[model samples]
Target: MNVYLAEFIGVAMLIFFGCGVLAGNSLKTSGSYGAGNVAINIAWGCTVAMVIFCLGDISGAHINPAITIMNAVMGTFEWSLVPGYILAQIAGGAFGGVLVYLQFIDHWEKTDDPHAKLTIFATAPAIRNNVANFFSEYIVTFGLAFCILGMGTNVFLEGLQPLATGCLIFLVGTSFGGVTGAALNPARDLGPRLAHFFLPIAGKGTSDFKYAWIPIVAPIMGATTSGLVHNALYKGIVDYRLFAMVGLTVVTFIAIKLASEDNKEAIKNKQALNQIA
Candidate 1:
């Protein structure tokens, strides 16, 4: 199979299962409504593993751009191929998200919470703290890239990488995922989010473009720096770009914090008003 085509298929599979779970959990009329964290946690991990199992041999099953970028950073993947792979993943994810939306077309009217409807397609912050939400994405994605590299260095059973990623996703979800929904992949969130924005879904809220940059930028920063970190610790290679990236991230988030204070307060006040009403 063509590698780009494989990536498209792989990520579509990812969104099919991953968003499929969210759809079930979020749609009030769905059987899996209120299935809660355990269901999503397991579904995401299993979905990743399934994508890998089906497409690992073809396009390396890089359903996530973060993974694709990490491979490029580590020199295992071609930088030239990176753009195509990422584009394919995003398109595929959007395709899958739309399919799931159509599958539950009736449920949209049945479920009144626009936020819940949005959750079926994209991630949202549990607490809406831009700085912390940004930091949390980096933390989990760093773990994701770092551990994936760790897995690469060691000898595991021939078919074990998928399972390893599955378990790792489970860990990422249960641990720091609550803050940002662990959106470690830009394509996973952005693709479906774009769909949500343009598709005219009934009662859908803002696509949350203001918060979108965190998932895209933070995950890339985390994944790439983890490659640098892995090289420093494991290969005794201290890439100075690692420190540069860190310094830049710190400055970036500080600015984000300062600029977002009023927006954050407004959001909090809105929530408070909702509670009072």
Candidate 2:
């Protein structure tokens, strides 16, 4: 299969299964009541693992712009192909979100809660705090990218890397998902946000545009930082023994201090702009 085609299919499958869990939980008539955060997180991890297995040979199964960017930064993927991969991923994700909406249109109509409807389509904080939410996404994406970098380096573990990636995602979700719903993928968040904008779901809230940029910017930063860290470690600029300890310590510190501060400032600016408007 062509690489672009594989990306399309892989991303579609990701959204289908990942968003399927959201629909299962939120939609009243779906018969999947009580399926909560743990279920959604596991579904996301498994979806990623399955997609990678299905399309790894054909496309490396990035299915995410951040992953593609990281690969390019790490010299694994050609820069020329990044646009196509990102486009395919975004399209597939949007399509999958639409499919989920179609599957639960009746339930969406029945649910009068705007936040609940939007939650099914996009990520929101369990508690509405900019600092914690941004830190949550930053840490999750940083951990995920670090794991990807490690997997990319170990040739002997290449075949098992997807499973490792899946496990990292599971850990991140299980550990820190409560804050921001673990939207570690920009395409995953924005595609469904777009779906919520276009789909005829009543009472759907604003796409939370105020906080939307965090997932996109933070994940890219995390992925790029991970790539740079990996290169440093591989080149012996940093001791491999200290890689995890130093790398994670740096990532966590940056996430908590820099990203969270930036997010708070952005929120303040957005609120100021809204007030002026």
Clashes of each: 0, 0
lDDT of 1 by residue, 1-277 (tens): 9999999998788888889899998888999888888778899999899988999999888888988887787777899999999999999989988888888888888888898888789889989777888889988899888888889888888888899999999888878767888899999999888888888688987888988898999999889888888988998877667788778878988888887887778989999999999
lDDT of 2 by residue, 145-191 (tens): 87777766677555677777787777888888777878888888888
Task: At residue 257, give the lDDT of candidate 1.
Answer: 84
In candidate 2, how many Å is residue 159 off?
5.7
The pairs that clash in candidate 1 are: none
RMSD of 2: 5.3
The ten-residue window of minimal lDDT in model 2 covers 237-246
Alpha-carbon runs more than 4 Å astray in model 1: 261-277
lDDT of 1 at 207: 88
RMSD of each: 3.7, 5.3
Q: Give the number of the best model, judged by lDDT.
A: 1
